[model samples]
Each structure stands twice: as C-alpha cells, then as structure tokens.
Target: MADTAFHSARQRYADLGVDVDAALSRLAGISISLHCWQGDDVTGFESSSQSLGGGIAVTGSYPGKARNPAELREDLDKALSLIPGSHRLNLHASYGEFGGVKVDRDQIDVSHFAGWIDWARSRRMGLDFNPTFFSHPLAADGFTIAHSDDGIRGFWVRHGQICRKIGAAMGAALGSPTVTNVWIPDGYKDTPVDRLAPRRRLEDSLDRIFAEPLSPAHNLDAVEPKLFGLGSESYVVGSHEFYLGYAIRRGKLMCLDAGHYHPTETIADKLTSVLMSVDRVLLHVSRGVRWDSDHVVTLNEELLAISHELVRNDLLGRVHIGMDYFDASINRVAAWVIGARNVLKSLLIALLEPTERLRQVELNRDLTARLAILEECKSLPWGAVWDEYCRRQSTPVGQSWLDEVRAYEQLVLSKR
Candidate 1:
C-alpha cells in the first residue's frame, strides 16, 4: 500500500519534471556527521570535576545520560538505527578514551581516540573531530588563543595542533578524510577597548596551529566563527567576518554554524557567497530559538531554505553537512534520531524540487509561472515519498520510530 502511494506520488512529481527516485538515491549517499556530545549532554568522560565554561551551557537534567564511552556509543547506536541513510560521528577532544587515566585537553593524542577509530571502522562510519576550547580552567576567563597571557594562549595552540594530528590519524585508520574544526570561545563579556590586539593574537595563533602540512586526503581543517556566546555576549573575537576573511586568505574550509549567526540571518543566503571563494564549506546544522543556543534541529523554514539553496546551487559535493546540537531535555537518543531525520528529510525535500525547471523559468523571466509552480510544490505528496524512503531504508516510517525510541528508553536508557 505504501509502495502504491509512493508510486502515485512519484508520478505526480514526474509530471512536474522531478525524479523522486533520484532524489532518494542522492539523499542516501549524503552523510551527516552526528555530534557525539548529544548522547552525553556534552559532558565528555575526560573528568567529572570539569565544569562547563567558555560560554557553553547544557540545560535540563534528563536522566539516563551516558556516563562512559560504552554507554555513549550504545546510545548512539540506538539513535543511528532509528535514522535512515549513512551517517558519520563527530567527536570533541574531551570525548577521547583515557582508560581511567587523567588525560588533560592539551595532553590528548591520537592514542586516546584509537578506540573511536576502531569503532567507526567497524561500522564503516567516518569520524569528524573538534578541539575542546571551552570548559577548561584555562578557558574559564572566556579567552583562548587570543588571551593576553602568553601561557594560556600557547596551551590552546598546542591543543589545536594535537587535534589536527589526531584527525589525520583517524582519517588514515578509517580510510576517510577527517574534518578537524577549530572553534574557540575567545571573546569578552563586556565591551573591550582593545579588540584589535585579541584578534591579532588569534590570527597569529591560528597561523601557528595550521602551519603543519597535512594531506587533504588525511584531514581537512575548518575554522568556525560565532556571533556571540553566553559570557562573550558583548563581543566575540572570532566573528563571521573574521573567519570568512581568514578562511579565504588561508585557503581553509569555513564552518557556518546555523546557531552562530543572528536570528534574522539565515546561512542559506551565504552559501553562494562563501562558495564563490572557498573550495569547500562545512555546515553545522542546528536550531537556535533566539540566540546561539544549540537546540535540536527540525524541518523548519530556515533548514528547508538551506537545503534548497544547496540543491539549487548544485553544491551537495562541495559542502559537508554535520549536526551540532545538544538537548538533554528529552530522550537523548530521540534527539539524535529526530534531528538527523529532519536534516535528511529537508535535503530530500530540496532534492525532490524541480530546480532545473524553476531555474529555466526564472532565467526566462517568467515570474508569474515560477512563483505559481514554487507555491504549488508546497502541496505535493512529499510525505508519501519520505515514508517510502524510510521503508526502503528498513527503518520505521512517520511516528512509528517514536515507539522504538520509547522502547529503547524503557529497556536500555531506563537502566542507565
């Protein structure tokens, strides 16, 4: 019955010059990097005494949070099972396996993440990494890499170097390039008189950190910028313009996090602008209610616009999609599954659009028909096609996955 519905819907889209099957196939091939912190409330197992700092905060004290790597991986596996299509794992430096030994952020190496590589290799999943710039004693002052204190700045610089090396090692071990993203919460809570000094320091530190030559096949470097953060509301050192200019000048990938910009500014519009200068781009797909709060992703207008822009520009191959949100308010696994599915669903929706025809209409200056066709597409049977996609992937369709999450919560999460 679902197949019949999908076939009928497919024909409807075909009449509109859209190939539903091709869209599904393209969507399945695109891999989204799932953040590991979502499974454990961003509390990596590095140290229990480590307080969350650096403009980072995880609200809600939901029970059954993963306490160790084993638990976190188990929870992630459950979440991945519910989400259809291939996916990757994104890990922070704090999430490295220490084997009961005290491994500080600066001292972490590839050895600490060897187990993670093995785990990813077993599942045939790629791994992305991030340098932990927040939540450390050194970063408590809301400065890193740009701190006035030379000692503090050097410590973070070393951490970034080590992370790049580790990222390369993971890529070599897994036979897939690892994207090592560098994001620092270096800003001031209040207005600063000497903002130039900090930015200059940051530029120098980044230069030193990325000086090492690494093959792109092994690891690619990306620098992420933020508008503002909890403690850095007054001013953010790594603003969008700073990183945009730096990325273009340095020939590195620029990360545009959805929650990192102003509420009114959507990254969908910046896609073409950035892609014009950079070879590759990274997207941190997230949702922010009113600020840079890392809320779980959903199929909203902004998300759909991002997807549409990517598809409209034919940039699926030029951009790397990664999920970046941590909401401990609900079932953590459910959060992952929900966010991942929504991202894929948004891309599927974009892929199913008749972009070629729409482009031709706009090119021919047929404004009336273009507007009419685009509005008509909103009422298409996209849901039926999405349900078929889930069926084809051997995963639950629609609300059925919610039941699986509840069962997992009761049987697996409840015990934790």
Candidate 2:
C-alpha cells in the first residue's frame, strides 16, 4: 500500500544487507497539518507543494479540521470518519467554527474534545493541534496578548488556558505525545520602543501554561514560529523559537517548522541547532516552499526520495512529516494519503543515500551537522542540558516586535 517508488530503495537495500527493518521502525512518529475543518479545502495545497519539494517532511492525516463552537462533536465525527482506517491524525488546526475567532468557550459546551480522545483510543491514532485565531482582526496584534486595548489585550491568555486544558487531557490519551502547537500570526511592520514591558507579561503568561504539572504522556509541546516580509519595518518573526526555552518555567520542547522562516532565512537548521544547543529539541519536522509557509510541499518523487534519505541519516527524533497546506481542491482523505505516501517514500529513498551522508553536512537550518552534535551529547540527557537551553531560550519579548504593530495601529487611529 505504500508508494512503490518509496519502497524500491528499501527493497534494493534489503538485497544489499543494509538493515531495512531498523530504518522503518525508526521512522515512526509522523505528523501532518490539516486546514480542512477551518473552512479551507486545503486538499490540493499539499498536492501542489509535494510536486516541488519531492515530498520531504510530511506524514499522517492532517485533515485540516477546525473546531466550531456550535458542533465540535459533529465536526469531530465527520473528521474522524474521514481519516482512513490506516493512518493517524496529527497537527489539527483550530479555525473556530462558523467564522468566530478562536475556539468559542460558549460554543464548546458539549465535550467534542472528548470525542477526539475516544477516536484516538478507538483506532490507536495520534493527534496534534495548532491553535489559530482568525475573524478577530486583533489577532494581528499577535503575542502581545498584553495589549491593553479594549478588544485586543488578553486574547493569548484566553486561548492559552484552552491549550493548557487540552494539553492535560491529551497527555492522558494513548499514542498522542504531541498535544500542543502554538503559532503566532501577529507579525508587525514598524518598530516600537517600549517592548520589554509587554514581553515580560507574555512570557509569564506562557510559563503558567507550560508549568501546569505535566501528565507525562503528553510530552512534546509544538512551538512553530514564522517570518513575514514586504513590511515597512522589522517584526518578531523567528526569535521566539529559542526564547521559549528560557521562558518555559516548566520543562518544554521546541518544534522546528520547516515553512515558518523567511525566503532568505532558511531557518530549519538554525532553529533546530539553537534548540538542540540548549537541548529543548523535542521534535523535528517541516513543510512548505523553501521560502514561506505556503504550506504546499513539493510533490516531486525525487525530492521526496531525497528528503527521506536525509531523515534516515540525520537520526531525527519522531519523523512527523505531512503537508502544511491550506487550500481546497482534493478530498481530505486523498490529500492526506498522498502526503503520507510522499513522506514515507522520501524516507525510503533516504535509506538509499550512502552511509557517509554526514560528511556532506552544510551549515543549513535543517541542522544536518547538529544531529551529530546531539549524538555526541550522549553523556548528557535532557535532564543534563535543559538548564542550558532554558538560559539561551530566555529572551524577553522586546517592544520592537510590538513597535511594528504600534506604529501601524497609531497611523490607523490617526486616520480615523
């Protein structure tokens, strides 16, 4: 049932005595990003991108399911029904139902959240959720959840509490290690002067969420940061990835999203290396064009094959590869299957690469060399390097990120 080409390399290696069994087992933890339930078809998004990346890092059923306040359970059943019997669910995007911004606590009366747990338990599936706030123009305010404006301030906390609660419940589920995903869309264009004041408040709020006594089962906290350009000034795009390490009062790990960096930035290796250097590197995965979070991954077979080779050689922990696409055209089920196959195939091809793939390490963000760096840290487990990571990750949110927004907002108010 796996892609024939994806398997060809493995079969060939089997003929050559390259330990195929070990490779497949090592590639277990695959996850995907779904934007379907959020009202975006997102079906063709992956199809289009996979054509380019050759299907590098993508796996699992990213149904693109969004939770609606009115019928969370209804949508849950519909999405669960859509996931083919074979695959697992990962990276669920919460695009508040009926076009309300964020998950409406008012509409979440019935425990649709419970159904996902039951669904995973029933089919032995895994689920990863990303909290998204749309419909609220203020979301552009981004992480400065500290904004004291009438309708803007505190969105982060309101939504944050929900994430923490979900994390607790998800940690209790079987086969679901990655329970939380945080991505801030508030990118600013101008610079602000007084940023530290707000940054501290945001960090403290985040601490409250992560410090909630962990359930252990819920292990990976997915931290995906993105960058935006074509702006009048600089915005806090990629800096927060490492800042998380220090701010997490409770232990937490960072997830390096492949598409979140700017075009020239190519941050996969940089973020991963930074996280690894400090030791908050819990998971490694990616999607999108090399430049932006277009979410569409290259569908080229050769590319997928090559990426697979990288994963095999890199020793990446939990390969949750799946398309981070959000558009409509293909069936959710088909898109998921296609994306999954591309990722699986890519891994197979990676095995075909010469064993010395490590020798070719370039200073890229995918952290090709850092895998070796991590390998050398055998003497120091996470308990060993957590403090160091925390120290490096402890960047306080500066007003600069906010300054970008403040300048724009002030201009808008002046015009009004």
Candidate 1 has its poorest 10 consecutive residues by lDDT at: 47-56
lDDT of 2 by residue, 1-416 (tens): 22343355455555544555464444334334333332233211212221211111223333332223223334333433333223444433342222322334323311445655675577666656654433234454443344545245455556655665565566556655654655554435678665565555556556654655656476456555445533312655334544555425344555555555554444334534453444444332335464335443444543443364346446354334434553334333334334444454455445433344344454355465657643542322222122221122331122232343344334431232
TM-score of each: 0.99, 0.61
1-416, model 1: which lDDT tens digit per residue?
88899999999999988988889999889999999999888888887666688888898888899999989889888888889998999999999889888977789999898888988999999999999998888998999999999999999999999999999999988888999999999998889999798999999999999999999998999999999999898999999999999999999999999999889999999999999999999999999898655999989999999999999989999999999998988889889999999999899989999999999999999999899989988889999999999989999999999999889888988887
**Overall local distance difference test of candidate 1:** 0.92
Write down the worst ten-residue block by lDDT for model 2. 47-56
Query: How many residue pairs clash in model 2?
Result: 45
Clashes of 1: 0
Q: Against the true structure, whose TM-score is highest?
A: 1
Q: Against the unseen true structure, what C-alpha lDDT does each candidate score? A: 0.92, 0.43
lDDT of 1 at 269: 97
Q: What lDDT score is found at residue 331 in candidate 2?
A: 32
lDDT of 1 at 111: 89
